[model samples]
Target: MSPKKRFEFAFPDIGEGLAEGKVLELKVQPGQRVKQGQTLAIVETDKVVADIPSPRDGTLVSFGVKEGEIIEVGRTLAVLELEEPDSGGGEAGMEEERSLVGNLETATSAELPPSREGREAAPAGPPVTAGTTAPGLGQPVAASPVARKLAARQGIDLAAVHGTGPGGRVLRKDIAETAENGRPPAAGRVQPLSTLRRALASNMERSNAIPSAVIHELVPVEELVALRRALNEGRGGEGQVPRLSYLPFFLKFAGLALREYPLLNAAYHPQRQEVEQFGEVNLGVAVDTEEGLAVPVIRRADGLSLPQLQAEVDRLAAAARGRTLRLEELRGGTFTLTNYGAFAGLYARPLILPPQVAILGLGRIHEQPVARGGAWAAVPHLPLSLVFDHRVLDGVYAARFLRRFMDLAARPQELLLL
Candidate 1:
């Protein structure tokens, strides 16, 4: 007979460039039985909200972090009690870090330090969210970490605040609205920036450092509109079909144009002072999520059919909104596209994401009066903005690429054949 030893389980490295995550939730409480692969916590990184799972089956002990606090990788998340009947060594429960979304690279127990109690005595702590070794919400509340932090700062009761976020989760906006009418804390108090905001600040600082330029065009797309209508109709061959958006069409043409001008599909290495040209068209589509901006990559864009592009766009967009996107999905983009038109934006000189040299911004399609063959007519026009890193590409090269893409997009039916 052997006594069960408590082991400290640390958070594993989730992915490259991913360092810290806010503990959005705790799934298990102290003294609760847990199984391998069961979610221990819902951690929100700057990229996504991941369900971090337990590696070995054991009884739950306590957590080292609070719900709203930032925890770095390799930090111990929870302690677990396990009986090592066979090993009979100091290391019993320590194993490779497990995750519900993907497996972390911690393949051996050597990655985690031994329990402070020497894998013998039980861990000391209370069951709750961010004090030292805190207990988690056995059942989590439907509220984001930002909302929780905001409510605490303002001394607003969360149970009364109406949540407008998806699934009725309280968001920061919801908290702000409550403050506008509640008898809470004083106004104009400084608030901590959310994880997403901090990342955005870093990216904006990098973007400001780059010398960029933008070129815009308003091209009539009556033919393109008719072509899209036909494609949507073809989906059902009859009555109302899904509104296939203009983005997939725009992106498809963008890929074809990139094939003609390969330099547009390239990255700038500032430190190395060199340009890396790409033969493949991997479009990074910027999606606005509840957390913030997320750009997921669509690999081999030139090879995928329009329908395939639409499917990929839908999957990635949904993953971004739900905070389920993996780290790899957010990297390796040679070029980027942003459809600001979805939000009624007429046009924008969108900032270029780092390394990638070019970005195309699309505004919403609308009907405007235009002269065709000396006749005035109301026609749909797609607004386009091509922003490029001046160091990697000159205006002439970018303009040529944009013109080629526009020409291809106008002939919507022709794009399908290619």
Candidate 2:
């Protein structure tokens, strides 16, 4: 029998201070072959569902964890057996080769390197005698350019304020808080950003940096509400009675509008200097979680009927709350719609998720007096806020799109036809 080779695969730091995650689904079996970057499993952290990719190309020998199991950082995920054992030698031999490479590179370098004892050695370029300014002394104190400017603006004495950064350098947060509080600087408290918080912050920042604007419209949803009630009561005409919500109606209308104005169902790539108009409309529905907000997408929304849309919405929402949504389910959105009305918010400027060109926000639905057939009557009305990237879509195009949505939402029978 051939000797078994052990290749350990440890969990990597996926750009956030995520200490643990629950395995939602395992994609590979114990003996399956996996390539580098191939998704091995789906892990649900508090914030988002990320695909755990294989870091090495090999055959999976053993899986260290199971589905629905919670794992901590630095834990072994899987073990692999290399097809060729002698390709680069085993793990220990590979480490020795890496060390040899580092030594050779350092030996050939011009600059004096640090000692093997892991302590800073004396500078070898020139000798400094007593009474002469040392190499680092008399030189400007090491601080970030932003920190220096902040200190100058706040009239802060850097010498008095102890730096919490590397080599005792002051950071921006240290200066700002100190200047604002009008108190002596103290040791900085480093709180690592949670996985969800970091993802939320990054998404919000990106949305803010994108050129976006919101256009408001009032859509009378009397018929839409009636349709929803009928559907929920199993009285409506359909293949299967859908778990109804206002979202499917809104999505159907949005999808129809996308067919009319394809620009809204597209993404603007700033680097590529291109606007990609997707042939299919994939709508994202924003769901509020305890940690923050997350938008999971419904791929190919244009192809789904109202009942199908409702089913998908319910499934995705449940998956999101359960933290079982796949990474694929969270991606490939051409546009997004957030229903803040469920929580009783009137209207809000919802941030757009780039490179998607637009997002639709649904505000509180309430009974309001409306002029109908030359007489004032109480009607169910919803406030719609459409935010789109000004770079990719014009105000005129956005207005037209909202008008189409209003028409469909006001008389939902039109959506059945589309």
Residue 196 alpha-carbon offset, candidate 2, angstroms: 1.3
Q: What tens digits encode model 1's per-residue C-alpha lDDT throughout 1-418? A: 7677777777766655666877765667778999977888877767766677787789998888766567888778888887656454444324422232133444633222211111132233343324323223433445666677677777876666666643344677788988987644444445556667777778878887889999999887889988777777657445544457788888889989999988879988999999999878899999997668999999999889777888899999998876667677887899999999988888898988888888999999899998789999998988999999999889999999999988886776676466
Task: Please report how far candidate 2 places residue 170 from its true position, in Å.
Answer: 34
lDDT of each: 0.75, 0.71
Clashes of each: 4, 0
lDDT of 2: 0.71
Write candidate 2's Cα lDDT for 14-38 as tens digits.
Answer: 4233467656445666778889767
Off by over 4 Å in 1: 1-8, 29-34, 57-62, 79-188, 234-241
Minimum summed lDDT over a 10-residue window in model 1 is located at: 110-119
Q: What is the lDDT of residue 305 in candidate 1?
A: 78
On the 0 to 100 scale, the lDDT of residue 8 in model 1 is 74
Model 2: CA > 4 A from native? 1-84, 88-191, 235-242, 372-375
